[model samples]
Target: MIDTHAHLDFSQYDTDREQVIEECRRNGVQFIINIGVDFQTSKASVDLAEKYDFIYASVGYHPHDAKAMTDSIFEEIAQLATHPKVVAIGEIGLDYYRDMSPRDIQKAAFIRQLQLAERLKKPVVLHIRQAMEPAFEILRRHPGNYGVLHAFPGNAKEAAEGVRMGYLIAFGGPITYPNSQGPQVAASLSLSKIVTETDCPYLTPQQFRGKRNRPDYVRFVIDKLTELFPRYSRDDIVRITSKNAARLFNLPVDDSPELAYMIGKSLYLNLTSRCTNNCYFCPRNSGFHVAGHNLRLNQEPQEKDILTAVERYSGYNEIVFCGIGEPTLRADLMISLAAELKSKKLPIRLNTNGQGNLIAKADLPSKMRGLIDFVSISLNAQDETTYVKICRPQFGAKVFPEILKFAKDCKEYGIVTIFSVVDVPEIDIDACKKIADKMGIPLRIREYASD
Candidate 1:
């Protein structure tokens, strides 16, 4: 997890800063960006970043402190920004609600800092308050992934515009509170541009509401967000939001492969683990990895959850429901999900062991008329005896003939059916091709190994 906004340089953490930083590390908080509100705080943030490799710094003057901004201080900030640890030029912007600094001074500081951000090629962390209109106007004038609207107060229109200009929207601790618009706004925004932050030493989450907030508690904000956005799992949120942070802040995040990732123009779903056959060449035997993606899901994804994963990586050429397992075990889910994805013109495909007839305890092939555009069945063996010996299906000898019937019925339904084999030692590819020809459908020979 990444804390996109925090102030570890503040006095509140001075008592036990090292311990807090260590705690953040222990709690799986991989990175933290300490934000500076003025020259002194900015210097302190740089100092913290220099001390810890995982901590980055963002330097700028807050609108509340705009009264203190001057030519020399601005130049000092410009110099401080050159520090290698600095990643952005904020928490800067208008704060008319507090009126701690006059509107004109705050505007001047905000505009100057934005110009500095553009000059430095760094994203800006904005702090707009009850001044979305003016902030939007200024942002419209100076744009391009401008930065996150830190602790964004509910403004759907402004949030949409910020996303359009390639800005991210960060949700902090306030979203965890009951009866808050922050969460509603978060639900409304594109999850692609959303990130989570702690805003440490302020706006602690509901469980720790009246206390000092820490970077680690950013997980609580994420947890609340997970509750608000039920479709997204914790891992999905972490991966997607982490990607957004890395893109905007240029974070050097890890490039670990996905358990279900895009290959070419397709998105493959792999949340299912239950399968009927235990083929000798089962890919799961190889560290549960498939095409570099770890297909071992912690839990089976619900139908809606599958759609959620699709939506996260949507707009692919097609969505394929195939993994290390027999996808037909969740035949109902695949059918319903395919029906839903079809409306979006996503063209759904399902690669299975052709055991749907047995699992549903009824004829299942023709049931997939409008639900799926394509179906591929694993036909590792041509005859029942060889199939029982190699595929080792739990259904025993009868399973192979049932698979053949399933493929034939699928072809009759005009579902663009195909049969494929893994090219193991004892399998007869020619025999499988002959069966495919006789069945009036095509046969595909899948690669035996990804490497």
Candidate 2:
């Protein structure tokens, strides 16, 4: 895991700083970005980065100390930011909650630092607190800047707005607190735009609350993320968050494609990227990434190649024939793989857009009976017109009734069938739920992500 925000250079770590960093290395922390809140801390952060290869630095003046910032200090910060080890210009922006610095002085410092970051071509680590409106106003004035909303204090809507503006939403220890809005916001946004941090020597995780925070405790943050995103495994969280930090800080990290990826305890197979419908709400519309796994395949895998991929994993609760694309496009391969996987004594599930029978020109549901244990069909809209408008099926509006018929056939064939709909504005979730109810199937409402 990567701790995107930390202040290990502070006095709290003066006694056992080296020991804490060692603990981070032992705890699987691949990288840590030490943040600079003022001139002294910024230089210290750079020194820490120089001392350790895994540690990077972000040099900037915190809003609380904005009043002390002068032209000379700003020039020093600009020069410090040029260091190869300095990855960003951050720990900056407005902080009205503390009111430690005059609001006007804070805004000026924030803008000056933002301009510096923009000129340096580095992402900014925003520190907005109870000043989101003004902070967003400044961000709007400077449209091209992109970075993270560190230790985000805003609601999901505000977080969504930041994401729309090309900034990532960062979560820290406060997310682990009971009755906090962190989980709600985390669940609302896509994991692709989320990154984890510890904000060491400050907001500690619930398990370690009332004590000083450390970079190694980032695992607790990852644990909270796992709970919020049950579809992704702990390792998946590490991989994805590390990738996000690496991208923002331009750190060297491995990010490879996966043919079979696990979510929760289920292993999902990516047999093909070919699909029958082009759903506007689909993540593929924006990118091929889902839960951090790139589902865009250069070549469709055969039965042997899939089995080889599956052999690398173990302890999965079930096998799911699902990817960014429609698995049913490779109906024969899916069935053959399911049959092969039956010996593993694990249940199998198929996530589809309910166009299998139409594509195969056969009773695909009946064909799946006994081989596929559960099926999740996409019931995106309540009626044919809505389906055509949102799904854009290759077979057009005529394919809508056939999708309903397909769900019915799955149930008739004794498969545990479920319907799913993305909660996009174009979709009437209640109406879709009613359709699922009438069909006697459960409806899963997926949160829509504009990113």
Candidate 3:
């Protein structure tokens, strides 16, 4: 994971600085960006980045050091910022709490630095204290400069302002503090605009609150975040935040197309939204995506389009023809791509409303024999009338019996068959499970939750 903010240049780590970094790597801390507060520390931050492969630098002036700024210092910072290791301009902004520098001087220095960062085409890492509104007023003048709000100490309104400006909200030890507003703001905000940091040698988390904070302890910050963001799993938090960090800093990251995405070991292909049935419990009623992926098709994907999406990966457990739509709508494309996909020596699963036989009209079950290893049919309700009421299939009252027949045909043709049902409050769960059991098919119940 990337620790987007830290101050390893401070004198606090003089004796065991190297040892602290070693400990960081051992604890799986991948990258640490050391921030510069002034010219000297900025130079030191650069030296640190050049010395260690895993470390990077950000060159800028801090508010507390604003009084010492000079024309010459700004020129030197400009030169230091040109270093290839430098990723951002900051730990810079207003600090009314300390007033170490005159507020006027702080304002002037902040604006100049903002202008410098804009000229350099680099994002700024903000450092705001008690001067939130004033600082926000300053930031309003500089639009289209995306950055991170380091160690955010603002309320939800302030947080919204930062997000509106396209800035990412960063939290550290303070977020782990008891009764803090950070977690609430984090919960309210989009996960894609959040990042993690340590601000190391300072702002230690609750578990190590009294001691000097290290890069390795960013884990505690992430842990606290998970407790507050219970809706997202730990891996989801990591993947989303890591992607955000990579995007902001131009770090290397992995991505998949919206049309094809991974969940666990399976790669799911969303071809189209054209389905034979419109179930009330279907997630497609609310959105075209699932698990934060945008599955809405711009156009129905062809065989070549699917090949472009799925052929890049090698280790996926299976290629699933599961979308918010009916994969049977493009059964011909599935058949066209089957031989090449089968050559990959990986099993393929198709998820549908089990109306492929009706959609294809001529020997679909037999044609699909060797191509598909498993078929997951959406047999949502138990009886014919209930199925019609829930599914509202275009195939009419005969559709329920046809789905059962399709399942039996798939099983007979040497393919594994499974039935899936969404547990809408009024649906009979036991009854659906019993029907699946009688048909010798496994039942998997899907839970409906708010996005």
Candidate 4:
């Protein structure tokens, strides 16, 4: 796990800073990006980074101290940012809730640091509070800068907008608070756009709230994330959030493609990255990541390759023929692989775009009678027009009816068939639910993860 934001330089940890950092190392905290709020703290952050190979620094002026910023101080920050261990420029932005600095001064300081980060080609760590509108407006005017909205203080729509503008929304201790909006906002955005941070020596997790926040306490944040994303495991949260921090900070970490991944005891196989529809809300357009695993495959896996990948694991509730792509595109391979896996007595589920029959020119569901126990078909729209508008299938206007027919065929073959819809703005959930009810099939509403 990576604690993206921390402040060990604070006097709160003066007596046991080394012990806290050592505990973080033993608790699997891979990296920590110590933040600087002023000239002295920036130098202390640099000192910490230089002392520990696993620690990195981000130099900038906090909005609370914007009034104290001068040209020379800004230049000092610019110089510190050039250090190899200094990965980003931040702990900067407007904080109207405090109003410690004049709003105008805060704005000017924010813009200057933003310009510095842009010229330096480094990502930023924003700390906007009640001044989200102005902060976001300033960010819009000064485009081409990307980073995280640290300790994000906005609604789900704002989070989506930040992601659309190439920024990540970070959630920390507040997420674990009762009735907090963090879980809802986290659920609404793509896993790829979410990162975990402690804002340590500040927002402590609920389990240890009121106590000083430590880097190792980041695990509590991950625990809350697991509840928000029930499909993902604790380890998935660790790897995914760590990867997000690494990518943003250019930290050294392994980010290879995953062929087979586990999510809540089910092993999902990525047979291909090829898809039948180019849905507007699909993550493929931005990044082929689903539940934190990179599904962007360089090559489609063969039958033996798939078998070998699964052989290294056991105790899965089921094997899912699902990835960012339509698994049925490789129909024969899926059927053969399912037949072989059936011998192990574990059930197999297939998640598809429901164009299997159209693609194969055959009743594909009938062939998978005993092999597939459950099948989820993407009934993404209530009608053909909506389907065409959202899915934009290569097979054109005739795809929707065929998908319904495919679902019907699967039910007739004794397979548990279900209809699924992504809850995007374009989709009519009530209409889709009516269609599923009329057909006596269950409809599963999937949250739209904005890219």
What lDDT score is found at residue 283 in candidate 4? 83
Q: Give the whole-model CA lDDT for all candidates, comma-separated.
A: 0.83, 0.91, 0.85, 0.91
Query: Poorest 10 consecutive residues of model 2 by lDDT?
Result: 254-263
Query: Model 1, poorest ten-residue lDDT window?
Result: 255-264
List TM-scores for all candidates, in order.
0.63, 0.90, 0.66, 0.92
**lDDT ranking from best candidate downward:** 4, 2, 3, 1
Off by over 4 Å in 2: 177-190, 227-233
lDDT of 1 by residue, 231-303 (tens): 5566667766776787678888755434357654678877577788888778666556543355777778887
Better of 1 and 3 by TM-score: 3
Candidate 1 off by > 4 Å: 256-451
Note each model's CA RMSD in angstroms: 15.7, 2.6, 8.7, 2.4
* lDDT of candidate 3 over 55-139, digit per residue (tens): 8899989999999989999999999999998989998999999899999999999999989888988889999999999999999
Clashes of 1: 0
Specify the poorest-scoring 10-residue window by lDDT in model 3: 250-259
lDDT of 4 by residue, 407-427 (tens): 999999999999999989888
Counted clashes in each candidate structure: 0, 0, 0, 0
Where does candidate 3 clash, by residue pair? none
- Cα-lDDT of candidate 4: 0.91
Q: Which has the greatest TM-score? A: 4
